[model samples]
Target: MSVTVCLGSQFGDEGKGKLVDILANNANLCCRAQGGNNAGHTIVANGKTFDFHILPSGLINPKCINLVGSGCVVHVPSFFKELEALEKHGLNTTERIFISDRAHVVFDLHQLVDGLEEAELANSFIGTTRKGIGPTYSTKMTRSGVRIADIFDPEIFESKLRRLAHGFQRRFGELLKYDLEAEISRYKNYREKLVPYVIDQIPMLNSAKEQKMDILVEGANAIMLDIDYGTYPFVTSSNTGLGGVLTGLNLGWRSIKEVIGVVKAYTTRVGSGPFPSEQLNEIGDKLQGVGQEVGVTTGRKRRCGWLDLVIIKYSHDVNDYTSLNLTKLDVLDDFEEIKVATGYSFQGQKLESFPANPETLAKVDVTYETLPGWKIPTTGAKYFYDLPVNARKYVEFIEKAVGVKIRWIGVGPGRENMISR
Candidate 1:
C-alpha cells in the first residue's frame, strides 16, 4: 500500500489529530514529519480526550507503529512528560513509538534563549509557543545542534553540552538563566530514558515501503506557517507544507498516494499575522464561543473570523491536495446567514491570488459570498444528505470554489462525529 499524508489546509489546530486518529486505525505505521512540541493535536476517543504534543496522534491506535522523524526537534523533558502521561492513560507505547536518532534535541537552555529572544523583539515577536521550536531549528541549520545519538556517548554529550552552554552565554549572556552542571546532569538522566526509543527512522520507513506496509505521515502546524511560502517573519521556522513530508521523512514523492487537507468551517488563527477576513464583531464572538477557539499548545484565545476561500484556495494550490475535510460545521448552526470570502481586493484592486506581501494582505478588502444558514442541529448527521439543505449548499459551494471534493465533514468532537461523503 502507498503512504497517505494528512495536512492542515489552514493555520495550525485544524483538528488534524482527530482525523489522523480515525485514519490511523487502518495504517500499519504513522510518522510525525516535522515541527516540534510547539504544535499540538487533540483527539477525543471513547469519550476520553487525548492531547498530544511531540508525540504522534497515531499513538491512540494500539496496532500502529509511531515514529518521530528526523525533521522534528525533540525536547527531552517535554517528550518524557508526554510519554508518562500516555502510559497513565493506559496506552501501551513502549514497543510501538520510536524517535529518530538524528532528530535535534531541545534543551532547557533553548527555551531560555527562546524567551530571551522574544523579549528582545518585544512588539515584533512571532508569538511563539515559547517551546524553543524556532531556536532549536535555528541551531539545527547552523549545524551546532545536538541530536538524540549525541547523548549516547558520555564524553561527546558532555563536551557538546558545554559548548552549547558557552555559545548561549556568549550570545545572550545575562538574559539566559541556566546552571551548566545541573543541566548536564539532568540531560544524562534524560539520555537514559530516551535511549530505548531512539532509532534510525529513515531506514525503518524505507524498509516499510519496500515491504508494502501502509504508512501515514502526520504534519504539524499548517500551510500558512511554512517558512518559505507563508507570511514571512510571522511563520514557523520549518516548512509545514507538502515538500516538508519528503525532507522530513526522507521519502520519495512517488510513495505518496493521497494528500488530505483539513479545514475548519470558519478561520481561526493564533499569534500575530494579517487575517483579512477576521470578524471582530458579535459573529466572531459567537463562533469563538461555540467552536471553543483556543490554541491547544499555548491555550491562547484564537482569533476567529469568517471562512476565506482565498486562503483555502492558496493552500490547495500549494499542497496539491486530493481531497478536503471540512471540520466544525456544527459551529455555524445558530447563524441565520454565513459569509465566506470568495476573493481579496487590495487597495480597491481585485487580486487574482493570495498576496505574498504582509502589508498588502493587511490592507486587502475581502469579497464575501453570503449563504443562508441551516439554523438547525447537525451534530448527529451521518451522511451528507442527512444535513440540512442549506448546510449541504454551503459545503457544495466551497467544493466548487476550491475545485476539490469534500470527503469528510466534521459535526462534533468525537471519532464517530463525522459524515463520510
Candidate 2:
C-alpha cells in the first residue's frame, strides 16, 4: 500500500530515471505526473540504454504497469516514436502502458508557436526545449487546449483545433507558420493507434488504492524549475514540486509514504538562469567534460558548479523530501578540493531563503564552504562504508545540513553502480 514520489531537487538531469527504474522493480504501477516530451530521462537497465521522453521509466520492469496522468501534456508523434523504439528493443509494451483521457495534446502548431515565442524573446529567451510544452500549457491554462478525449470526436476536435490555431495566428501574425490541415490528417491515423492507451485515470488509481498496490510517481523536471517555486521567467511552465503530485495524479497526501529528492553531487543547469555558484574556470570545464554535462532534452552544455546546498535546502522546504539520493559522486573523485554554496548574501546582508526576483538572485554573492576531495574513485564501491573517508564526510555533510538521510548514492551511470543505505 506504500506510495513513493521521486523528484529532482536541483535544476533537473539529476538521474531520476535510474532511481525510478531501480525502485520500480517492487512496484505494481508507475505514473508520470507532469511535463511533456520537453523533459527527458536516460535509463540504463538490462544492458539496454533507454531515453524516455513521454513514456514512464517503469516500462523497464516487466511486471509494472505505467500511466501518464492528466497533469501531463502529450505530444502524439513523440509518444508513438518512443513506443516504437521501446518495442524494437524487445520489450513487450502492449497492455502495460496507458495515458489519461484528460491530458492535453501537444500539436505541431504549438511547437511552431514555441519557436516563434522564443525567437521573439531573443537574447533573454527562457531557453525552452521548443517541444511545444510551454505553448500547450499556455493554451491549457487559457481553456483553449484539446485533450486526449477530444481526438475520438473528430468533428469537435477539428473545430477546437482550428480555433486554437486562429488564436495563435492572430497573436503571431505572419511569424507563425503551420499546416493545420496536414496536422489534422495525421491525427486521423493517430486516433486509432491511441485508443487502447487512453483511459480515465480516476477509477484506475482508485482501484490501485483500494487494492493497496505499491505505487511510484515519477516527477519530471526538478523543484528549481517549478513554475511557482523556481526562478521566474527561467522556470518551466508547470509545478515540478510536491504540489504537482497532488494536482497531477489526483492522489491524496496521506497516500504518499516517502518523498525522495534526487541531488547530483555537483550542480548543473541547462539554459539561462541566475547561478550563484557557477565556476567558469578550469574546474567548470573539467566537471563538464568528465561528467558529460549536456542536457538530455535540449542537447545544450549544462553550466557546471559546486554543490549548491542553498538550492537544495530551498527545494527541501518546498518538497519536504523524506530522503535524498546523491548521484554522480564519482564525477568529483579527481578534484583536489570540493566546494559547496552554503548561503547567499545580497549587498552584504544574508538572505534567509531563495530570492524570488531573478535580478536579486543574479546579484547575490555566494558564500562557499570548501572541503577536501576524496581523490579516489568511488565507481567500484558496493556499500556506503566502501567509500573513502572524505567521500563519506561529504555525503554526511549534506545529510546533516538538510536534516534528511542519503538513502541512496549513485557512483556511476549504470544501475549496478548504486549503493543503498
Question: Which candidate ranks first by lDDT, i.e. highest?
Answer: 2
Best candidate per TM-score, number?
Answer: 2
Candidate 2 TM-score, C-alpha based: 0.99
List the global CA lDDT of all models. 0.91, 0.94
Question: Each prediction's TM-score against the native?
Answer: 0.98, 0.99
- Give the per-residue lDDT digits (tens) of candidate 2, residues 1-421: 8899999999999999999999999999999999999888998887888999989899999999999999999999999999999999998999999999999999999999999999999999998999999999999999999999999999999999999999999998888878889999999999999989999999999999999999999999999899999988898899998999999997789999999999999999998888888999999999999999888888899999999999999999999999999999999999989999999999999999899999999999999999999899999999999999999999999999999999999999999999999
Counting only residues 3 or more apart in sequence or on different chains, how many pairs clash (N, Cα, C under 3 Å) in candidate 2? 0
- Prediction-by-prediction clash tally: 0, 0
Task: Tell me the spans in candidate 1 whose CA falls farther than 4 Å from its real position.
Answer: none
Give the Cα error of residue 80 in candidate 2, in Å. Answer: 0.3
Q: After best superposition, candidate 2 residue 198: deviation in angstroms?
A: 0.3
Model 2 sits at a Cα RMSD from the real structure of 0.7
